[model samples]
Structure formats: structure tokens, C-alpha cells
Target: MKVLITGGAGFIGSHLAIRLLKEGMHPVLIDHLSEELPHARKEYQLKQVFKTGPAAYYNCSFLEREKVSAIMEKEKPHAVVHLGGLAGVIPSLKDPSAYIKTNIDGTNNVLACAAEQNVKHVIFASSSSVYGEQAGVPLSEDMATGRVLSPYAASKAGAEALCHSYRHMYGFQMNILRFFTVYGPWGRPDMAFATFIRKLFHNEPITIYGQGTGRDYTYIDDIVSGILLTLKSKESDVYNLGSGRPVLMSEVVDEIKHHFPNVKLLQKEARIGDVTSTWADVSKARVKLGYDPAVSFKKGFEETVAWAKEHSDLI
Candidate 1:
């Protein structure tokens, strides 16, 4: 079957596209190559995984309704994996308007295009940030999104609602994945793992926010596996893509020090829009999607360290 993956040149997008291709599915990628990220990563994904020529790449913004609609109509893909958005919490605070427009509006455009084009299914890449520093431990999918502290979280929540509305009215299947702290090889440079790895490599001090806040750091492989299984199930549902095991920021720092040995620490007050902790209760994903994360934080971190060392030139 043919699939359309928005943000297909990105970290999770590139890896997910690779996974679909390996399963003999053709993925048409729509991404804005705005020179925002390192060109090396873009070249690697475009050349390595998509080199076989079964893939199509469109360097267009998803917020442009006419452009997205035209592409969606032409492709008429069996499924649309909507992974495009204005990422990062801190940046969302700086430019809430841009985040709202790109994420919420862009998501609306994708849903509208999918509904109009009659795509079989639309899968959204939501975020655990929507939980918004919940008082409860092991946040569940059923929990109400009560006070979104950041514009980024609000946009993701809005996107989820839009997808649900389309599913309810149009009978289109929509799967929303609330991915938690995804990290590993080919991960985004903005994330903690990549930033920390870069600092370690440069012998620069790594910053720790919220005095070692805890997080459920899910690996890329496990998150991708959950997405693939959810696609096969073909059900309109929400699932938590996370390791279910939380790691404190201090613990992460300690682990990094073990690897780098000379890595210095620069403690800082928690930045605004930062969450103190995040833990996911994956019971729903386990039962409905048959999802089970196979990687441990320790193992995943070790592997990521190795990747950082090998790809030092790129990092």
C-alpha cells in the first residue's frame, strides 16, 4: 500500500519511512526543507533510505492548505502519517503564534485534506507534553488535558481533537500517538540526548534543568515498532509510546559522565515551560495495540553513546 508521511525527512519521520519501505510499502514524503536542521541528516535520509526511488519528497509546508490538498489528492494514499509540526517546548514559548499556526493549523489542513481525499487512515504524532506536569504518576491516555502550560502542548492537544472530529464525522480511522521523550540514533539535535552528546564530545559542560527532572525516555526503535503495529490494527485510538520507566535528569547526567569521564556539569534553574517529570502508563497500548517496548534505558543510552562517537563528524 502507498503511504504519505508528513515530516518524512525528520528524525522519527525518516526512521518510520525506512520501516515502511522495509515492509514493502511505498511512502510519499511531504516535508519543508527550510534549512532548519543540519544538512547532513537530510542528505543521509534522502540518499540512504529513499534512494531506491520508490519514495517521493515534497519540500512544502503543511500549513499551506492548497498545496497539501493538491498533493493529497494526487497521491490518494491508503494511509497518511501526520508527523509534521513546530517541535520543541522552549521554542514554542518564544513563538507561540508560529507554533499554533504551524502545528494546529497544519494539522487541520492535513485532516481536512485526508477527509476530502478519503484516505483510509490518518496517524498523528502527538506528544506527552500534553499531560502538562500532571500530579498523577504514570499518566494514562484517559486523563483529561487540563491546563496546557506550553503552546506546543496546546497545539498537539488541538491537533488530536481535530483528528478525532474528522474520525467521528467522516468515519476515517485516526490513531494518535503521545510519544514520550523519544531518543536514539538519528534523533533530533534539539533533544536532550543529542544536545548532551554534542556537549560531551566538545568537552563542554552539559546543562541540567529542574535539578534533574525525570522522564520516560522511549527509544526510536520501540516507538517506531508501536507505530507500525498501530497501523496494522487500523483502529482510531490513542496510545502512549514510551518505555514506562522514568529516568531522572541527574541520573542521565551521571550515566553520561560514566561514558565521557571528563564531562562537566553546569547546573541551571529549570527553564520556563519545562516539566518536572513524565511517566507513561502503557496499559492501553499494550492491550489494544499489542505494543511492548523492548529496549531498556541503559541499553538504549549505551547504543546512543556509541552512535554519537561514530558519527562525531555529523554531531
Candidate 2:
């Protein structure tokens, strides 16, 4: 199978590309290498993917409809995985327009191009943020969306709707995966775990917000596995790709302290748009796609820290 992944140079995208190559599939990647993140980090990720195996790459934004269409026409991939977007709840609040434009509008372009090329399968990368401020634990796909707390969450919800519409009209297989707090090697630097590691390495204080909110921190490998399963499935539906384990922020801090005993801590009020907790109910995915997350938080964190130490320059 030939697969095309937007944001292919990103953390999850790069990992997915390497995995696909190992499975004897061709992977084509498109990434604008956004200014929000360091180009060095993205370039490093690409290097890792290339080192693993051969893959085609394009440095272009999906926002450019013509370019996206041209790439799709040229590649004629069996599947398209849409993962490009502006991420982060706090950053979304500061500039909601950017998030809306990239997440929603950019998604539309990808889907439109995929439909035009008659792609067989399309996987839209949504987020757990769409479940926003739920009092309930273990969020499921059947739950209502658009109760979003942040513009980023709203954008994902809107993009999911677009996915549904395109699937209905074009009659193509559509799989929407709502990812939780994914972390592991090559994780985004803006993520809480990444920031904590960076601060600790420099002997700087790490900030804790909102009385240690809980999150379902899924490992990057698990997420990639879930995506691969969906790619091979004939059925099209929404699935939550998460660990189904919620760990409090305080617990995460304690885990970090285990590595860096002298690490300083700073407490601060939670910023707006931050959810109190996120827990994924992967029952549907388990039954439908045999999606099982293997990595425990402790093990995943240890591996992440080890990788961070080795590649301190990238972070």
C-alpha cells in the first residue's frame, strides 16, 4: 500500500512513516515545516525516517489547495492520513483564527483532494480535546462533540464534521481517530512532558498548573499501531487512540523527580482552554480494530527521558 501523510515530518507522522516502511508499504509525506516549531527538530525527524527506509517527501502546506491536489494526483496513494494542523490549547486561544484556518480549512483541502483522486481510505486525526470539560470519565466516540473548551478543540470537531460530509458524498472509507495526550520519543516540544524534560535538563523550574490535572497520556507507538489497524480495516468509523489510563499531573511530576531529584517546581493557576482531565474509552477500538496500548506511563516516560538525554540539541 502507498500512503500519504500530511505533517509527515512531525512526531507522530514521522513515526508512522517509519512503521509503514517496516511493514513493506510506501509512505509519502507532506509538511510545511511550520514556523511555530524549530525547523531543526522537523529536519531531524525526517532524517530518522529516511534513515529507516526510502520514502518520498514534499515540503508544502495542505492549505494550498492546488499544491495538495497536485501531490495527490502525482502520488495516487492508496490512503491519505490527515495530521497537519496547529496544535496546543493555549496557543489556540491566543490566535484562534490560525487554528481555524489550518485545522478546519486545511482539513477540507486535504479531504477534497483525496476525493478528487478517488482515494480508497482517508484517516482524519482528531483529538480528545473535542470532548471538552466532560464530567464523565472514559470518553467514547458516541458522545456528543462540539462542547469544545478551546478553539483548537472546536477546529477538530469542525474538521470531523467535514470528514463525515465528504465520506457521505464521495462514498469513500473514512476513519477518524481522536488522539489523547500522545508522548514518546520525537514528541512535540510544546507538550507538557517534553517541556518538563527540557527544563529539568537545564536545571530550571518546571511549572504545574490546575492542581495537577489528569490526562490519558498515550504512547506514540500505540497511536501509530491504531492508525495502521484502521488503515487495513474495511469498516469506517471513529476510534479513540489512547492508553485509557489517566494520570494526574502531580503524579507525572513525581515520576520526573525520580529521575531528577533536584528539579525545581513552580505552581501556577491553570490557563483558560485547559481541560481538567482526559480519559479515553478504547472499548470500541479494542473490539473493532484490536487496538491495545502496550506501554505503561512509567515505561514510556523512561524511554522518552532516555531519548531526550541523547538528543538534547533537538529539544
Candidate 3:
């Protein structure tokens, strides 16, 4: 099978592409490689994927409807995984228009092109941010997402609605996976885990915001496993691919301190658009997609630190 992934040069997209290649499937990637983002590791991530195997790559934004359509027509992929978008809650607040344009409008283009090509399956990468400030502990898919706290979250929710509409009209299988705080080797530099590691390496102080809030902190491999399971499923639905356990920011900092004992810490008020906590209820995914996240925070962090040290120049 051939699969096309937008944001293929990104951390998650690159990891997914390598996994698909290992499963004897062809993976095609499209990414704008935007320079405006906080990270500049797109080239490094793509090199890692190439090390695993040869895959077709296109450096183009999905916002360009004609280019997206042309790529879809040329590839004729069996599935489309939409993962391209401007990520980060704080950044989204500063430039909500960019988030809306890329996350919502760009998604429309991808969905339209997929429908035009008669693609069989599409997996939309949503976020746990959509369930902002929920009353419940473990967030379930059935819960309402009408109270999102950030433009980034709102954009994902809007894109998700578009996914359903396209599925209803075009009669194609659509799966929306709401990812939690995913972290691991080659993780996004903007994320807390990577940021902390970089600071520690340079003997700089790591900032702790909002009284050390908690996050699901799901591992990259586990997320990829969930994606692969969804790819094989026939049903179209939403699932939360998370660790189902929230780890406090303090605990994460402590874990990093275990490696860098002399790391400095800075405390600051939590910025706006930041959620207090995120916990995932993966019961639906477990029953429907057999999604099981096995890596613990300790083990995952250790592996991530090792990877970062090995490739210190990249981070």
C-alpha cells in the first residue's frame, strides 16, 4: 500500500514514514518546511527517514490546492494522513490567523484532494487541546469540545468537523486521532521535553510555568503504533492516542535533574492559552484499535535523553 502524509518531514510524520516503510508500504511525504516555526530540524528528521529507506518527498504546502491535488493525482495513495499545521498554543495566540489558515483551510484542501482522488482512508491528526478545561479526569472522545481554550485547539476542532463532513459526503473512512503531549527521540524542539533537554545541555535554566502542570506525555513509538492500528481499521471514528496517565511538570524536571544534577530552574506564571492538565481515556482506542501505550515516563525520558546526547549537534 502507498500512503501520503502531509508534514512528512516533521517529527511525527518522519517517524510514521519510517514505520510504514518497515511494514513494506510506500510512504510519500509533503511538507512546506516553514522557516517561521521555532524548529529547524526538518532536514535532520528527513535524513533519519531516508536512512531507513527511500521515500518520495515533496516540499510544498498543502495550502496550495492545485499543488496538493496534483500530488494526490500523481501518487494515488491508498491512504492520506493529514498532519500538517501550525502547532503550539502560545504561538497560535500570537498569530491565530496563521493557525486558522493552515490548520483549517489547509486541511480543507487536503480533504478535497483526497476525495477527488477517491482515497480510501484518511487519518486526521487532532490534539488533546480540544478538550480544554474539562471537568473530568480522563478525557473521552464522547465529551463535548465546544469549550476549547486556544486558537490552536479551535483550529483542530474546526478541521475535525471538516473531516466528518468530507467523510459523510464522499463515503470514505476517516479517523481522527487526538494526540496528547507526544515526546521521544527527534521530538519537536518547541515541546517542553526537548526544550528542557537543550537548556540542561547548555547549563541554562529551564523555565517552569503554571505551578508545574501535568501532561499525558505519550511516547512517539506508542503514537505510531496507534496510527498503524487505525490505518488497518475499517471503522471511521475519533480516538485518543495517549498514555492515559498524566505526569506533572515537576516530575519531568526531576527526571531530567537525575541526568543533569546541576540544572537551574526558573519559575514563572503560566501563560494564557495553556491548559492546566491533560489526561487521556484510551478505553475506546484500546477496545477498538488495540492501542496500548507501554513506555513509562522514566523509560521514555531516558531514551529521549540518550538520543539527544547522541545527536547533541542537532538539538
Candidate 4:
């Protein structure tokens, strides 16, 4: 089978690409390489990523409708893992228009092209942010999405609705995977885990927003497992892919403090668009997709710290 991953060079995208290769499926990846990452240059990373992998690469934006369509027509992939979009709530606040254009419009173009080409399945990367400011534990997929706290979350919600409509009209599988706070090696610098690691290593003061703002921090490998499962299932449904363990920001910081005994700390308000806590009710994923996350918070954090040290030059 051939698959197209939109953000193939990204943390999850790159990892997924390698996994698909191992599965003997042809994986085509297209990414804008927009983020200003701290570690290595995007070009360098892409070179190292695809050096020996049999995956194909296209350096472009998801908003490029014609190019995207051309790729779909050429690749004729069995599935398209649509993970390309501007991520992060705070960054979305800084440039909401970009998020609106990329997440919503980009998804529209990709699905339209895939539908035109009769792609068998499409696994979209939605976000837990769609839950908004709801006061609840174990956030479920069926819960009503309240006032979206950020443009980024709103775009994901919009994309989810769009996928539903397409699934109905086009008669193809569309799996909306709502992801929690995923972190691991090659994770984005904007993410709390990476930022905290970099700052602490540099002896810079680390900022903890709402100190207790917890997240269902999923591991990278586990998420890739879920994506591969969804690709095979061809189920038109929404599933939450999370660790099912909500770890607090304070606890995460404390763990880092263990690594760096003198790590400085600073507390601040959990800025707007930041949810107080995110906990996923993975019963549905467990029963349906057989999505069992194996990596624990302690193990994942340890691995992340080790990765940070090895890639310290980037940090």
C-alpha cells in the first residue's frame, strides 16, 4: 500500500514515515518545514531523515492546492495521513489567519483531491483542544465541544466537521484521531517538554503556566501505532489517541529538577487558549482500535531527557 503523510518530516510524521517503510508500504511525505526548530536546520534534518529511507519527499505547503492535487494524482495513495497544519494555541493567537488558512483550507484541498482520486482512507490529526474549557476528567470523543479557546483548536474542530461531511458525501473512510499532548525525541521546541528541557539545561529560568495544567502526554511511538491501526481499519469515526495518564506540569518540572538539581523555576498564568487539564477516556480506542499505550510517563520523560542531552547542540 502507498500512503501520503502531509507533515512527513515532522516529529511524528518522520517517525511514521520510517514505520511505514518497515511495513513495506510506500510513504510519500510533503511538509512546508515552517517551524524554526532549535536543534538542527530543517534542511539538514530532512536529509538525515530520508537519507536511506525509501520514502518520497515534497517540500511544500499544504495550502498549495494545485501542488497537493498533483501529488495526489501522481501518488494515488491508498491513504493520506493529513497531519500538516500550524500547531500550538499561543502561536495560533499570534497568527490566527495562518492557522485558519492552513488547518481548514489545507484540509479541504487535501480531502477534495483524495476524494477525486478515490483514496481508500484518510486519517486526520485532530486535537484534544476541541474539548475547550469544559470541566471534566477523562474527556470523551462524544462530549460537546464548547467555546473553542483558541484558533488552533477551532481549526481542528472545523477540520473534524469537514471530514464527517466528506465521509458522508464521498463514501470513503475518514478517521479523526484527536491527539493529546504528544512529546518525545524530535519534539517541537514550542512544546512544554522540549522548552523545559532546553531552558533547564541552559540554566535559564523555566516558565510553568498554571503549574498544575495537566496533559494526557502520549508517547510518539504509541501514536504512530494508533495511526497505522486506523489506516488498516478503514473506520469512519473519531478516536482519542492519548496516554490516558494526565501528568501535571508541576510534576513534569519536578522530574526535570531531578535531572538538573538547580533548575530555576518561574510560575505564570496559564495563558488564554491553554486548558487547565486534559485527560483522555481511551476506553473507546482500547475496545475499538486496540490502542494500548505502552510507554509510561517516567519512561518517556527519561527518554526525552536522554534525547535532549544527545541533541543538546540544537537546544
Best by TM-score: 2
TM-scores, one per candidate: 0.96, 0.98, 0.97, 0.96
lDDT of 4: 0.86
- Model 1 worst lDDT run, 10 consecutive residues: 45-54
Give the Å error, residue 81, model 3: 0.4
Off by over 4 Å in 1: 51-53
Q: Ten consecutive residues with minimal summed lDDT in candidate 2?
A: 135-144
Q: Rank the candidates by TM-score, best first.
A: 2, 3, 1, 4
What global local distance difference test value does model 2 have?
Answer: 0.93
The TM-score of predicted model 3 comes to 0.97
Cα lDDT tens digits for candidate 1, 1-315: 888999888888888888888888888999887565787887776776666557888988888889988998998898999988778999889889988888888898899999889999999999998898774499999874657789999899888888888899899888999999999987788888999999888888888876647999999999999989988886788899899888887778778878989988878898888888899999899999889999988889999999888888776
lDDT of 2 by residue, 75-188 (tens): 999999998889889999889999999999999999999999999999999999989898548899988557889999999999999999999999999999999999999899
Which ten contiguous residues of candidate 4 have the minimum total lDDT?
36-45
Instruction: Report the lDDT tens digits of candidate 4 across residue range 11-92.
Output: 7888788888888888999988775453254555566557647788998887888898898889889999998888889989
Off by over 4 Å in 4: 35-41
- The order of the candidates by lDDT, greatest first, is 2, 3, 1, 4
Measured with C-alpha atoms, the lDDT of residue 253 in candidate 3 is 78
294 Cα displacement, candidate 4 (Å): 0.6
CA deviation > 4 Å runs, candidate 2: none
